[model samples]
Target chain A: MIEAHQISVKIGAQFLLQGVSLKILPGEVVAVIGPNGAGKSTLLKVLSGEWVPSDGEVWMAGRPLRTWSILERARRRAVLPQDSTLAFPFTALEVVLMGRTPHCKDLERACDYEIARTALIAVGALHLEARLYPTLSGGERQRVQLARVLAQIGDTFSIHPCYLLLDEPIARLDLIHQYSTLQIVRDFARAGVGVLLILHDLNLVAQYADRIALLKSGRLIAEGSPWDVLTPEVIQSAFAMSVVVIPHPYLGCPLVIPSPGPDLVPNSVDLIGRCKEKK
Target chain B: MGTPAYVLTVKSLPRRRRSISVLTILVILLMAIVLASVGIGVVRISPGQIFAILVKQVGISLSRPFEEQQEVVLVAIRLPRGILGILVGAGLAVSGAAMQALFRNPLADPGLIGVSSGAALAAVSIIVLGTKLFGGLFHALGFFTLPVIAFIGGLGTTLAVYKLSHFEGRIQVTTTLLAGIAINTLAGAGIGLLTYMTTDVQLRSITFWNLGSLGGTTWTTVGVVAPFILAAIIFILQLSRPFNVLLLGEAEAEHLGVPVEPFKRRVVILVAMMVGAAVSMTGMIGFVGLIVPHLLRLMIGPDHRYLLPGSALLGPCLLLTADLIARTLIAPAELPLGIVTAFVGAPFFLWLLLQDRRRGKFL
Candidate 1:
């Protein structure tokens, strides 16, 4: 489990994250949802130990985050940044193999190669192993990155429950890929790994995330299950827009639909009829 | 997760095998070039005589006695100069590769970034002002003073450029390039001013230094610079793994258990040391660093594990070849080594750029 206790980050008199406390338990998916400049990425960085917290402390597996060596922390957690740009043309297999850096002394070991291949297979990108990374599409790149992170924490030598901290993993993916990616994360969570993701889509979060932490301007506004966090009042207050929260007809999860603004027409049927009458 | 329908294609395995073979070929080619370089000079030594001399020097008595003039030419003049060429070439190329990886750009070279010029300026200053400034102490220090001073200047300029380009924990590439340009210009101006103050003899030496030559290499100079280059190469080779990780970017590298700041510091220091040592000894040989690693990368991909060692081997080979051409192209009149390298390197670099542009891979 990963825990952040009253974490606050300040950069040149700007508060990037303020008094944010959260926990990611094994076998659970926690989604952080917020508006622009809500410090979602900053919070992920702090949690992943990429950025040190100015005020509070973070603990991973009962030890202070700072106490663990980088390699040890890396073995226990993997971070997926929003966008990872590569200047060199490395193959997909090579990119995945980079994740196994901290695990082995010799990079050329056959076991490491096997693990990397397994990771690529797991992400359904086995065919892309020989393909150059730059040639891959955006969605394919995202999957490849996912495979890399999976390989990072999937060391066969260690049996620790790893935590994955992802920043908008599905931000650029299409509909099917979005669901499949979340399903992959869910499968990892089900296998007792904690997954924390920063998400923009409310319905996706409602569908996959076991709990949602809603933030506005670097402060947590609400934290609970989707039903408890996705109320109309909470949505309106956090997002500065009115949204209707209803139950999904089949999945029994919350479905969020945005209500039109005061000046905008609400019904598409009425607009079409008005156009017909004018003709 | 579903099982992948496609079998795990031995994609990386073939590349690995090919890379190993390529490295072997490169090493063999470097050895051939070294032997060829040792044989061809103003006084041409036969390949058999060169071999006989080499074996005899190593305490192996050959059956046939070698001629005294051939022995002197091979052992005294050409050998030390050839070894120095190899050291300078390898050092510059390895440093160039490290700098390119550090900056995450292929175009970054020690010379382009003012490091070589910085060393040259310091060496020139010592040559021109050593007698006036330190008097007896400079003479007492003897041959060690130039390299020491040049190393300090090179390391100082590199650190300054690094500090200027780095803000917070991130290296800004544009800032680095701009800082490199500014430092290069400033160093060039300093060198020009030093040139203005020198006497006729000093001026001629300064011109030779600026053009870069291997004419003045001695065994003593070779012995002194070898250890620095060796240490730098070993240090850089060990860093190949971290350098590979760093290609993922600073933050990502840190997350992957790399101590990014310390790694960057070590890389910068080592690169400065290697480049400094080379520049102090050989004046300022350009483009060997810029060209070798790049060509190797295009051949063997960007895996630093292979790239670093590949550069080390190929660096010496290219330099030895260039030095051979410089010595032999005009027969009795030897061309400046740096001019030959630039003549070959500049057009190749332009070709690389044009190729990248045509492929729409412009940075």
Candidate 2:
């Protein structure tokens, strides 16, 4: 389990995240939802120890976060950013091999090949192993990065509890791959990994997330299961839009159907129906 | 969690790094260049005489009356020049590789941090002013003070540039480039001022120093630079894997266990020292640092294990050839070393830039 205690992050004169705290348990996939500049990414960064919180602390498996070195932190937890660009035309397998950096026997050693190759198979990108990473499409690149992170954690799946913090993992993915990526996260949690994924799509959060954390202006506005926190009134107050909340057709979780923004006049070319198709 | 897994990966990586295989070719080429350089000079001694003189000098007794002219030309005149070529080439190239890695810029070179300007300014000062100071004081310290003053000047200018580039505890690329320009321009004006005040003979010395030449190579200059150059090369090579980690970006490198800030500081210091020594000895040899490593990267890929050492060998081979032309092109009239280096380095660098563009990571 991962827990934070009044985590506050201040960069220079501005507080990017302030006194926001939450807990993520094993076998749970939690998604934080908010508009742009709502501290969604900042909260994830803090929890992953990519950015240190200026106030309070983070605890992992009952141990304080800062007590461990960055290498140790990386070995136990994995983070995948929205987009990453390699400077060279590295092979997709080479990109995945980088995930084994933290797990290498010595700091001077290279990656473990067997573990890296196995991780590629786990992500089902084993066929693209020889393809150039930069030449791959966006969805393919994201999966390769996920594969790399999996290699870093190795088979420690049953031993060391790994926390996966995915920042906008599929913001640019197409319809089919979006659900496929979500299924990978769901499977990870089923194997006892705790995932705190940042997603803007409320429907995907509603369909998959076991718990929900609502953030606004760098603070935790609310936190609970989808049914308790994803209310139409909460959505209206946070995003300044009306929404209709109802049970998912199968999952029984709350669904947010957003009304148009206050000033956005309804155009004849509407987008709601096509967006609902994704759910 | 155990050491066994990492040992397997670490051992395998070296094999992959060594599989480039061209290193053996480069070593052979360097050896051939070294022998040929000793054989070819104004006197045009035969290869046999050159080999005999080299062996005889190493205490292998010969039956014939020692060829005084052949030994002097081969051992005293040509050998120093060849060694100087290798030292300057390897020093500049390795330093360039380090600078590129530190800055994460493929275009970075030894002179990026103002080492060339620093050396030039110091050498010019010694040529124009030191001849008057130590030349008038103690004649024993007269001829040598220029290199000493030049080294101090080179190191000082680099420190000044480093200070200017460092803002808010991080050295940003734009700031480094801007500071380099400022230092180079200021040093350029200083060089111009010194040139104006110098006598015609002193002016020639300053001019040749700026242009870079192994024309007047001596046993003493080679002795002064060779050990330092070898030491620096060893130091830089140790950082090869660390440099690969650094390519992941500073935050990521630190997270992966590299001490980024310390690495940056050490690299800057080592590059400054190597470049300072080279410039003080041979003025400024451009493009060896910029082009050699770049060509190596294209040929073998961006893995620094091959790139750094490959540049070290290839750089010397290229420099020796350039210097050979500089000495022999006009026959009795030698061209400046910088002229030949820049002439060769520019076209090669442009070709690399074009190829990088085709690869689509130019931006």
Candidate 3:
């Protein structure tokens, strides 16, 4: 499990993240959803050991995060940033194989290559293996980067329960790729890897996320199962926009639809009044 | 989960046969260049006589006899010079490849660290003020004084750049480049001032040194430079994997288990040492490091595992070929080695840039 306990990040006088505590346990998918400037990426950075919090502490597997050597932490955790800017002529396979650096003793083994190929296959990027990374489309590059992070964890070769932290992994992906990528994360979680994702689309988050942590103004407004956190009152408070939450006919989850805008939607004022009363 | 099983389907990757073939070809080319370079000097020796003389040095008596003068010239004059060319070439080329990796910029070269300008500044200072500056000590050091002083200047400038760019715990790439720019300009001004102070004979030596040469190559100079260059090349060759990972940016490399800061620090120091040692001996040989690695990357791709070694081998070949032309094209009055390289390299590099632009793959 990866736990961020009362972590707050401060840059000068501003607090990017304030007293945000969260946990990603084994065999679970925790999605962090927020409006723009809600400090979702900063929280992810703190959790992934990229930034040290100004207050409180982070723990992974019952030990303080700082105690883990870089190698040991790398073996147990993998982070996929929002975007990776690799401007080299490396083939996709070569890019994927770089993830095996921490695992290999000296040179990468045949098994590591197999792991890399399997990762590409898992992310539906197998066909891109021979293509140069720089030549790939943006969506294709995202998938290849996803494959790289997956290859880094290599769950089949690791004995320890690992954590995967993704900051907007599906931002550039199409609808089909977005679902497929989330599904892949869901599968990894089901296979006992803890997955923490920062996502924008709430409807997809409603369907795939076991739990959702909603943030507003660098503060977590709500954290619970999708049903509890996706309520009209909670969504209205967090986004400052009226959203009608209704149960999906096909899926067993709440579906969120935003009421256009204050001037455009005639009923949005009424919905906001009702949400205020509930709040 | 207990070891999530994978049903392997993809075939294993092909072995590194291409890299092996490339290295093999380079080794063969280097051998031919070395032989041709050694045989083409003022006293021309046939390939057969050269082979006989070389074998005879190892206690083998060949049926073909060679002249004593030929053996004397070959062993004393040409052999050490050829070896020096190989060492300096390999050193500069490998250093270039490593610097490009560290900077993650294709245009980065050994000169970016202020080595060339600093060495030039030091060499010019010595030429203009050696006797006055050091009195009897400069004369006592004799042939060793200039190269040693130049090496210290190069190393000192590199360290200053490193110190200036290093902030808190991280090495800033932009700051390092800026620092290098600042140091190079300062060194250039120093060189200019010193050049102004020189007399007629002093000015001639300064000009010749600035143009670069292998004219004074001797066994002693080769022996002094051999260990530093060899150590640096071998060290860089072992870092191909780390270098490849580094191309993915610093944070990504760290996430992949590379200690990025220390790794970068080590590479910078070693490259400085490598380039410093070579520039001290040959003054300033250009283009080998910048062009060789870029050309090899185009042929074999940017896998440093192959690129580094390929550069190490091909660097010497180009340098030896250039040195041969430098001495021969102008006859008894030698053309400076640096001029020949620039005359060939500038056009070729521009053509490469045009090709990259046409392919829409400018680096």
Candidate 4:
């Protein structure tokens, strides 16, 4: 399990995140949803050990994440930052192979092409096979980055359970790739892997995430399953906008319809999550 | 189904692990340059005689009896200085190459970063001040003053650059460049101020320092700078993988488990040791550092495994060639090696820039 205790992150004098505590168990795909400045990325940075929290610390597995070497952290977990750009003309395969950095034997180079090939297959980037990564579109790049992260997870791991933390992973991918990406994460969750994704598409979050951790202005306002967290009142309170929450036509998870209104917000969720006093 | 299927077919065929072929080539080239550099000075000595004299000194003669006068010319005068030139050149090139990678910037050069200016300052201070302090001691120690003071000055400036230019874990390339430029300009003006205060002979010394001649690079000068440069090269060659990780940007490099902060600090110091020593011996030779690794990268790839040693060998070769031309072009008058490099390298830089524009990409 991965968990944070009393985590607080202050950028300059402003508290971007404060006194937040959460634990994610195995087989959990928790989606964190928030408005633009709600610190979703900041929370992910803290979670992924990319940014150290000002007040508290994070524990991965059972030990402090800080105690683990960088290679150990990399072997156990992988991160996909939002704006991962491919600046080189390295082949897609070569790029996927980079994910094997932490575990590539001899500390020199990689041998098995199968791992990278398989990652490409897993992410469905195979036909773009010999294509230069710099030539790929933004969505294609995102999928390739995910494949690279997956390759890292697959190669560096030693059966201690792997976690994937993605920051706004699907925002640029096309719908089909987006659905496939979520499906792969769901399948991984089912296989007992831990996955935390920051998502803006609430409908997909409602459908795919096993639990939703609603955050607003750096504070976790609500946490629960789709049925519990996606109530119209909760959506209105979290986003400060009215949303018609109805059953999905097929999955019956809550479907989101933005009502684009103002007064529907509860005065309390904001006063609490906004003020962000110690609980 | 809409996902590009080709994206999944990653590089699976077993390719040759990027090996040490680059190192082997550099080694072979170094030996060849060592042989060639010995024969290239203004006094035309045959390659045969160069080696014969070199061997006789080692107590193994191959051909004719070693001529005392010729051996004196080869071993004592020309040979040591040539070796010094190559050492300083290769060391500065490697330092510049490593610094470029360490800072993750393309435009970095040994001369631009105050290493050369630092050496120049040391050289000038000695000429300006040593004459008084050492008295007739000046005549006995005049030869040593330039190298020692230049090295100390280079070291001081290097530390200043390190402190002023680092912020958090990042090397502010722009700030470093500006700081180096600012320091260099100030140092140059200080040179001018020192120039104003000195005698005619000291003014000539300052003027000559600015032009960057390889005139007095004797065996002892080579002896002083060679070990530092050689040690720095070995250290830098070991850092190629870290340089590779660094090319991916600091955040990404750290994610790949490279301790970016400490490694960058080490790189700057290594660079200082190399360039500080080199510039102390040779005045401000240019472009070997900026030009060689870049050309090598285009010929091979951006992989520093090839680039570092390639720069090392190529840098010395280019410097020796420039030095040879400097000697032969005007005969005894001798154009400065710095001028030769600017003449050769500026055209090449323009061509590369034009090529980048044709490809329409930012390097």
Candidate 5:
């Protein structure tokens, strides 16, 4: 399990994350959802050990996250940042192989290569293995980066239950890839890896995430199973907008639909008048 | 579905094998160039005589008595200069490759980052203000004073740029570039100020040194700079894998367990040391660092494991060729080494930019 206990991150005078607490358990996917500027990415950064919180601490497995060496921490947790810009023309295979860096003593062993290949296959990016990264589309690059993070902590040699933290992994991906990528994450979760993803799509979170944490103004406004956390009041309070919470017809999870604001409601008389004028 | 054809093709022959073959070929080419460079200097020495002289230096008695003057010329003058050329070339090239990787921008070079200018400023200060600043200690340090001061200046400027560019543990590329520009301009202004204050003889020496030359190379100078260059090269080679990982971006590298901060610090220090030592000895030799690594990247891809070593080998070859031209182009009245390199390298760089533009990509 990975746990952030009352962690607060301050950048100068502004508090990016304040007294936020969350825990990710093995064999589950936790989705962090929030409006813009709600500190979702900052929370992920603090949890991933990329940023040191000003107060409180993070514990991974049995010890404080700071107590572990970078390599040891890496073996147990992997992070896929929101934007992984590759300026160089490295092939997809080479990019995937880089994930095996911490594990291998030398360049790479056959087993390491096998693990990377397996990751590429898992992400449905086997075709991209030979293509230059610069040539890949945004969605394709996202998948390749996902594969790299997977290969990092998902090595068959690792016996510990690992954690994968992805910040907006599906932001640039198309609908199809978004679903497929979440499905891949779900599979990893089922295999005993804890997966935490910061997502904008509440429906997808409802479909895949076992639990959801909603943040508003750097504070956790709600946290529970998706059905419990995706309540209309909670969504409205966190997002500062009205939403209709309904159960999905197929998956039976809570589906959030935003109500149109006053400005967006079209007046039938005005619309008809404009149409007549155009004619 | 079956496996993809591209995967199968890539799996058939590993890319590592291809990179290794390319590296081997480059090493061989470097050797050939070194031999050719050694033979074609001011007084032409045949390949056979060069070999005989090398063997004789190793304490092997020759069947025919080698001419004493020729032996002295070969061993004493040309050999040290040739070796120094190799060292400076290799050092600058590797530093260039490492800097490009560190900044995650191909335009990043040691010269662009103010390392060369900083060294030049320090050396120029020593030349112009040595008597006033150091008094009697200037002569006491002898030939060592300039390089020592230049090394400190180079290292200090690099650290400043690095610190200025780094924010909250992340390296901001634009800030780094901007800081480099700021430092370069400041160093250039310092050089200009020193130039204004110097005597006529000091001004001439400053002009000549700023233009750069390998004419000042001696065995003593080569011996002094060799360990730093060798150490930097080996250190960079060892860092090749981490540097490769770094290309994925800093956060990604960290996720893969690369201690990015420490790695970056070590790389900056080593590059400063190598470039400092090279510039202090040979003055400012531009473009070898910028061009060699880039050209090698084109040939072998951006795998730093191959790119770093490839740069090391090809950097020296390119430098030796440039030095040979610098010395021989005007004969007894030699052109500055920097002019020869920029003349060759600037055109090649522009061609590379045009090619990239034609391809609809801006590196």
Candidate 6:
């Protein structure tokens, strides 16, 4: 289990995360959802140990986060940032193979290559193996990066639990890719790897995540199963927008339909009419 | 899926084989250059005689007789000079590749990062004012004073540039390039000031050192430089995996289990040690680092496992070839090795920049 106890991350005069607490258990997919500037990404960074909380503790596998060596942590957890930058023209396969860095013995073992290729296949990026990473499209690059992180935490062979922390993993992906990506994450969780994802799409979160943690102004406003947290009132309080939560026609999960506020509705229509008048 | 797996395994095998062949070819080219460098100097020695001399030195007498004078020239002058050229060149190139990896920018070079200039400044200061300023320290260090001071200066500038361009754990690519320019300019001014303060003989040595020459190499100088460069190369070659991961960005490298900060610190120091030792012995030889690694990457791809060792092999071939041209171009009048490298390297760097611009990518 990965647990954050009363974590507060302060940068200069502002608090990015203030006294927020959360936990992720093995074999569960937890989605962190919030509007812009809600500290969703900050929370992910803190949990991944990329940034230390100004106040509070993060415990991973019953050990204090700071106490774990980077290699040990890397073997048990993998992080995928929102966007990756690689100026060098490394082939996509090479990039994915880097995920095997923590588990690499002396030279890269042949099985490591097998694991990396399996990861690329899992992300449906095996065809892009020979293409240079810099030449890949935004969505393709994200997939390759995802594959890299997956390759880092190998299969379920480990007796120790592993975790995957992702920040907006499906942002650049198209609808089909978004669904497939979420499905992969869900399957990974089903295989007993804990997954913590920061997602903006509430409906996808509803369908895929076992639970949702809604954040607003660095505080966890709601935390429960999707059915419990995806209520109109909770979402309205977090996003400050009117939303109607209806059952998915097929999937039976919450389908949130956001309605624009009263003032903006007429203003948008007026702007369209004004543009016609100008024409 | 099964077929694809088999094909993928088959596809990777040739690349590994090709990399090994590339290294093999570089090794052969290096040997040819070593022989050409040692034999083709002012008093030409034939390859066979050179071979016999080497055999004799190792206590294996060859059937062919060679003159003692020929042996003297081969063993005393050309041999040490050849060894120095290879060491300095390989050191500069490997460090250049390492720097590029460290900065995660293709254009990063020892010369661009102010390491060479910083070493030049320290060496110049020692030459012009060492006896007067720190006479006691100079006497104690004796032969090592210049290289040691130069190493400190190189290490100091590297740390400064590294620290300045880093924000939190991220490297600011533009800021790093800009800081390098600033330090290079400052070091240049310091070298210039020291140049003004020099006596006539000191002035000549400083000019020669600044321009870079291997004409002064002896067994003692080779002894001084070899340990540092060899140690640095050995250490850096082992870091191929970490350096490859580092190209993904610092945060990504850390996520992959590299202790990014400490790894970066160690790399900076090793690069400094390399540039410092090389500069101390042979002055500022530019572009061997930049050109060799960049060219090799174009051929072998940017896998540092191949790239680092490839640079080590190719760097010597380039520097030794350049040294040959420098010494033989004017025949004893001698051009500076730095000038030879810059003549080729500067235009190559400009072309690289233009290429990047054409592709619309700067960082």
Per-residue lDDT for B160-224 in model 3, tens only?
88788677545566787788889988987897788887788988777776777888778999988
State the local distance difference test value for candidate 1.
0.87
Per-residue C-alpha lDDT of model 5 across residues B60-139, encoded as one tens digit per residue: 86675457777887888888989999999999999999999998888788887888888888888888888898767667
Quote the positional error of residue A165 for candidate 5 in Å: 0.1
Model 5 residue runs over 4 Å out of place are: A156-158, A261-279, B1-14, B64-66, B135-143, B168-170, B352-363
Docking class of 4: acceptable
lDDT per residue for candidate 1 within A1-279, as digits (tens), equals 799999999988999889999999988999999999999999999999988999999999899999999888878888999998777778998999999888877555776677788888777788898898878999899888888888887763137778999999998888887898899899888888899999999999999999999988889999999999999999989888888888999999999999968755578888889999999
What is the TM-score ranking, best to worst?
6, 1, 5, 3, 4, 2
Q: What is the per-residue lDDT of model 2 for residues B22-115, given as tens digits with 9 covering 90 to 100?
A: 7888999999888777777677776667667777868996654545887787777888889899999999988888877777777777665677
- Which pairs in model 6 have colliding backbones? none
Task: Residues B199-220, candidate 4: write the lDDT tens digits.
Answer: 9987876776776667766777
Flag regions of model 3 displaced more than 4 Å: A155-158, A262-279, B1-15, B126-152, B155-183, B355-363
The TM-score between candidate 6 and the true structure equals 0.96
* Candidate 2, residue A203: how far the Cα is off, in Å: 2.3
lDDT of 6 by residue, A23-74 (tens): 9999999999998998999999999999999999999989999999988888
Residue A241, candidate 1: how far off, in angstroms?
Answer: 1.5
Estimate TM-scores for all models: 0.94, 0.85, 0.90, 0.86, 0.93, 0.96
Across B62-143, the per-residue lDDT of candidate 1 in tens digits comes to 7766788889988888899989988998899999999989988887889878889888988898888988985675677677
lDDT of 4 at A88: 41
**Best-matching candidate per lDDT:** 6
Which scores better on DockQ, 4 or 5? 5
- Give candidate 2 misplaced runs (Cα > 4 Å): A24-28, A59-64, A105-111, A155-159, A265-279, B1-19, B45-51, B62-66, B126-179, B353-363
| Model 4, position A259: C-alpha lDDT score | 89
lDDT (C-alpha, whole model) for all candidates: 0.87, 0.78, 0.84, 0.76, 0.86, 0.90
Q: Model 5 chain A, poorest ten-residue lDDT window?
A: A152-161
Comparing candidate 3 with candidate 4, which one achieves the higher lDDT?
A: 3
Model 4: residues with Cα > 4 Å off, grouped in runs = A85-92, A105-112, A126-136, A261-279, B1-33, B64-69, B130-176, B350-363
- lDDT for residue A185 in candidate 6, whole number 0-100: 91
